[model samples]
Target: MTTSFQKKTRSKVLQIPGAKPSIYNNQLLISTGIPSLDHILGGGVAVGTILLIEEDTYGNYARLMLKYFCAEAVMTGHSLLLASADADPEQILKELPAPIIDDPGKGEATLEEPSHDSSSDNMKIAWRYRHLPKFQSNTSGVKFGHYYDLSKTMESELTQTVDISTVDSSLCACDSKQTDGEFNNPGYNSLLKTIQEKIMANGFSTTTQVEKRNILRLALHSIGSPMWGEKGGLTENEMYSPALPRFLVGLKAILRTAYACCVITVPAHLFCDKAYVRRLERLTDTVVEVDSFVGSDKEKNPVYKDYHGLFNIKQLPCLNSLVCNMPDSLDLAFKLRRKKLTIEKLHLPPDLSETANRSQEDPLKNLKPSSGCGTGGRSNKLEF
Candidate 1:
C-alpha cells in the first residue's frame, strides 16, 4: 500500500589541471599564461577557441606572449605542441620565462608601508559610492593563472615535466601532384594534419580511449610570413589566396570536437589588402593586434613613454550564449619591465607642476609694420 521514490543523482564534472569553469557561463577555460591578459580576456580563454594575434611591426612582443603561453603549459602539466617555420621549437622551449611564486614576507612588507598622503585618510566618500564594490582584475574564486619573471629562464627540470611535440614546417615536403585549392600550401596541409594527429593520438579528442583527460595548448608562431611560403602579402594578386583561411577552417573544426585550444601569431602587417585581413579576422574566435612604437614617433612622445606598444582587441567570441565577454575598458597598453610584461589600462602620469612662465609676450605686439603699409601695398609684416 506504500509508494517509494528514488533520488536522482547528478553527474560530477571532472576537474582538469590548469583549467577552470568560467564565471560568466560555466564553460571550461584555460589561462593565456599572462595574469593581466587572462583578466582582460574575461577569466581566461574558453576551451576549443582560436586566439589570433596579429604580430607587431617587430614581432618582439607577440613572440614574448607566445612564450608565456608555453610556460604556463609547462607549469600546469598540460600538453604542448609548438609549430614554427622560422625558429626551432626546441630553442623556443628553452627560453620560457620563470614562474613567480608568492612570498608571505613580500605581502607583509607591502601592507606595513606608510601612506604618502596624509589627507587621503580623512577624505570622505559619498553615501551612494561607499556601498559600491571595489575594482578587481580577477574575479574567479580559484587561481587559474601564474605570473612569470621575464628576466629569468625556466629551470630545465621543471620544463622536463611537460609532454611536448613540435612540427617544423621547413622540414615538411610538398606533394608535386597536388593541385591549387584549399590548403594549397604544403606547409599548411602538413601543419593541419599534424595537429589532427596530435589531437587524436594524445587523447585530446572528445571520444578517446584514455582514462584521464587533459587540455592541449597549441602555439603557432609567425604564421603567414614569407618563410611559410604564403607570399607574405607581397603582391595584390596573391592577397586573396584561400590557403590560410581554409587552413583555419580545418583547425577550428579540429578544436571544436577536441579538448584543445590554439594561439596563432600572424604577420598581419605584411598583408596590404584590408579586405583580405578582414577575411582572416572573421575566421578566428578572438583577434588581437599589437602595434609597437619601437622606432616610431610615439616612442619619443611623453604620452606613451611608459608603454612599449598598444594592445587592441578586435573581436571576442560569444560562447554558449547571445552575449560575449567584453572587457571593462578598451584603452589598454602593454609594457615590459625588468622582470615582467604587463598589460594595463592606458593612463598618463599627472603633470602637477605649473608652467614656469604663464604670461608671455604677445605675437601681435612683436610684429612691426611694413614701410609701404599706408600706400595700399601688400606688407610682409603688419600690426593689428
Candidate 2:
C-alpha cells in the first residue's frame, strides 16, 4: 500500500524468527499459535503488548486460549513460561502439542535430517574453501508455531503455585543491604520482583545479543481468582487491597522492557462492577470479551452450528507501541473440534428453507385459481 512495498530491503516484520508474520498488518506480530486467530489479528499479536481476555459468561473458551498461548511459547523456542492459573506446570507441559515428527501433511519440521557430506574427523585450519549458500526453491511451508490437543485442565490435577517465577531464583535474589521502605514498597511482591529482575537481565539493549535474548510468554488465568489471594468481593475490606493492581502494573512495566508478551484471562463477571472491569481494561494494551449463546436454539441455528462461543475486541492497542495497527472493531466466534480449534467471523443464521418452498408452490396455487374462474375474474380488490 505504501512505498515500503517497493523497497529492496526486507523489514523486520517480513522476517519474524519462529513463524511467518500475518499477511494483513505485518508490522511486528507475535504468532498466537492458532491459524484462524493469527489471521484475525492481522498476523498475530504485537510484541511488548498485553492482551486481557475476559472469560465468556459460561467461562469456557478463554481457558483453551490461555493453554494454547502457553503451548505456543513452548513450541516457538520461548520455553520459559510464567503460568499463574489453576493448572500446574506438569499439566501445562502435557497440554502442549507434540513435535511434528510423525506427521508430514502439516505442522513444523522439527526433525530435519542431517546431510551425509560431513567429514569423519574435525577439519583443521585449512585454506580458503568456503561452503556454498543453501539452495531454497520452495518457501511455502513456514511453520509459525505448534498446536495442542484438546485438554481437560483441572484445579486438583495440578497444584497451583502462588510464587510462580519460571526463571532462576539466584539471579533475582535480593541484595544484602536494603532499607525497610524499599522492602515494604507496594510493588515489592516476590513474584513481581523476580519477573522485573529477569526482564532487566534479558531486556533489549544496543550492546546485548538479540539472537540470545529470551522471549517469555506469560499467562495469567483468572487473576482475581483464589490462586492470586483474592478475598471475596471488591467492596469493604477487599476494595482497599492493592495486591492485584500493583502486581499487574509492575508486570506491565516489566513486559515493556523485556522480550515478552502476555495473555491474561479474568473472571470479570464475578466482580459484577463496571468500574473494576473498566479499570482492568485501562491497564491492558488490548481487551476482548467472550460469551456463549445460552438462550439461542442450537437445533434451528445454521451459520454457527459449529461455533462454541462469541468474542469481541473491546479496546484496540494504543498507537504508540510496537504492536500492529489492528482494526478497532472485530467480530469473531470460536469452535472446538477434535484436535482442531478454530475461530471464524460471526454471522447470522441462514434463511429458512421453508420460505423457498413456499415461493415455489405459490405460482401453482395462483394458476389453478385463474383456470377455475369464468370469463372475467370477480375480484375483491382491484386487479393488478
Each prediction's Cα lDDT score? 0.81, 0.57
lDDT by residue (tens digit), candidate 2, 227-322: 444432242334534445566787787777666778888888776567777777888878888776655465346666767777777777754446
Q: Which ten residues in a row have the lowest lDDT in candidate 1?
A: 375-384
Q: lDDT tens digits, residues 85-156, model 1?
A: 878888899999998776222553356444423334445764445434443343433366877787889998
> Candidate 1, residue 192: CA error in Å?
0.7
List of clashing residue pairs for candidate 2: 19-144, 22-43
lDDT score at residue 182, model 1, on the 0-100 scale = 45
Q: What is the lDDT of candidate 2?
A: 0.57
RMSD of 1: 7.1
RMSD per candidate (Å) reads 7.1, 15.1
Residue 285, candidate 1: Cα error in Å is: 0.6
Model 2 bad stretches (over 4 Å)? 1-16, 19-27, 99-142, 151-188, 201-211, 231-235, 238-242, 293-303, 320-329, 353-384
